[model samples]
Target chain A: MRIRVATPSGHYRTPTYIQGKVGVIEAVHGAFRNPETLAYGGDGRPKQTLYLVRFDQTHIWAHAEPVPFCQNDRLLIDIYEHWLEPAPEE
Target chain B: MPGVHDRGGWPDVGPINKAEHELSFWEKRTDALLVLLSSADRRVIRVDELRRAIESLPPEAYETMGYYERWISAIETLLIEKNVLTKAEIDRKAEQIVEQRTIETTE
Candidate 1:
């Protein structure tokens, strides 16, 4: 799956680095309140599903050297469902 | 582009500082203030609101301010935005505190 590359003009949990990057879903974290609305005094209705996505460190950073933990090293982040979609076959 | 707070993979930033240090008195108070404001009983402020306020900070302040300093700054912004406090009120109160401290030092 790939994270959606959307630059919303308000509060969002997805970091900029992970946006538009391809990653594998490691776990499903269930739905939770939408922070975007909750941040602005709105009731967090209709929770969004969350997932633990894993990405290769090298894929994330051009200069990310496979140091002490080389290829096995991976970065895992929790992303909401709205920020993710199916990635095309590699 | 992501905000300045999104510095996940920037190069040449140096090693991560994992060293833990004791929280200063004001820092501890800031933490307690957040907890109290966000508590279910009060619901005065939410953690999400704080993060939003912190992210809204200008790049210079975001880059230079210490952690708790950012938190307090965000809390102040949110408080003003929510109408719980006004910029003038806070400014006047801060000036009074500073004046009191100066008087105490001289005494």
Candidate 2:
């Protein structure tokens, strides 16, 4: 249940750190108005789903230097559904 | 360029400043203003609007301004965009507030 935070241009709520990173969907926060449209004063009629995604510390720095990571260590991020894509089951 | 507010993984940007500094008096006022603006019977502004305003700031100001200053600028920007207040009026009112503060300090 990994969310695909695609790096697209324009008014976006997805933080750059979590963009393109894979994480497990820990929670579904229901639907809310799209912030990207709301930023421009337009009504975010079609609400988007927000999810709390959990990632391992090592998953975040897989490309960077290898750091000692504990199995219990995790990072959580709230992301909208539009920016997500399901990943292959682990 | 990416939104100014999205600074994650930007190598040049220094470490996250974690020092806990008490909110200044004016900062507290800004916080209160934000609450009233969004929590009032009629929602005048949304948090997304504020973030957009903060991201819309000039790169230098966006990068250098303090957290609360950023919030102030965002609030002002949103106010202007919504036609709730003009830039000139905000400028004048800011000047008056500063002048009044200085007088109160000296008196």
Candidate 3:
């Protein structure tokens, strides 16, 4: 399903590895962002755009050549919907 | 002007309330830095990208630039503690991914 990711403007801990990259919606974990931190002023409110995105494994490997066992590692992108798109068929 | 006791006597008026002025200056700087840091962490852009954005600001702002240094350091520390960006690398691993895409498309 097409989903939107949260993209808040600020200093965040999202790995540079996932920045600006698109991923498939492996599963939707619900919306959330760290609200207590200075980023959210401790408000604890989940950012509306935040979603757990699973990168297409084949695409991720093609780009990030993972070490054998590490291939299972998932990319949790804190993104806004504008950054995502439908995965091109293989 | 007049020496302390020469004119009327009190402590001479002093040079523009340096302490208060400095405090206000730093306070504003700190607030600005916080806004930028928050934006960067919210996934708007990478930290280095944010730094470049800050550098683009006017030179006068640099007078209080120490505030930026402190804020960046604090944010980096927090990110490290949370296992986000590491000291070893600043850019994301996205480049490698992009490269792979190029190879696949060509083949």
Largest TM-score belongs to which candidate?
1
- Encode model 2's per-residue lDDT on B1-107: one tens digit a residue: 45677776565555667989888899999988888898858578888788778888888998889988999888988898899999999889989999999999999
Q: In candidate 2, which residue pairs get closer than 3 Å at backbone N, Cα or C atoms, i.e. clash?
A: A4-A84, A4-A85
DockQ-based ranking: 1, 2, 3
Considering chain A alone, what is the TM-score of candidate 1?
Answer: 0.87
Error of 1 at A2 (Å): 1.4
Worst-scoring 10-residue span by lDDT in model 1 chain B:
B3-12
Clash numbers, per candidate? 0, 2, 22
TM-score of each: 0.89, 0.81, 0.30
- Expressed as tens digits, the lDDT of each residue in A2-87 for candidate 1 is 99999757788899888888999999999999888899988887899989999987777745564555666799999988899999
Write the number of the candidate with greater DockQ, choosing between 1 and 3: 1
DockQ of each: 0.74, 0.53, 0.01
- Taking the tens digit of each residue's C-alpha lDDT, what string does model 3 give over B14-48? 55545533446656775565576557456433344
For residues A1-90, write the lDDT of model 3, one tens digit per residue.
233233534433343345444576655556554432434334434453555677644544465434464556665455544445664455
Q: Which residue ranges in model 2 land beyond 4 Å of their true spot?
A: A88-90, B12-18, B95-107
Cα shift from native, residue B49, model 3 (Å): 12
Segments of candidate 1 deviating more than 4 angstroms: A62-69, B18-20
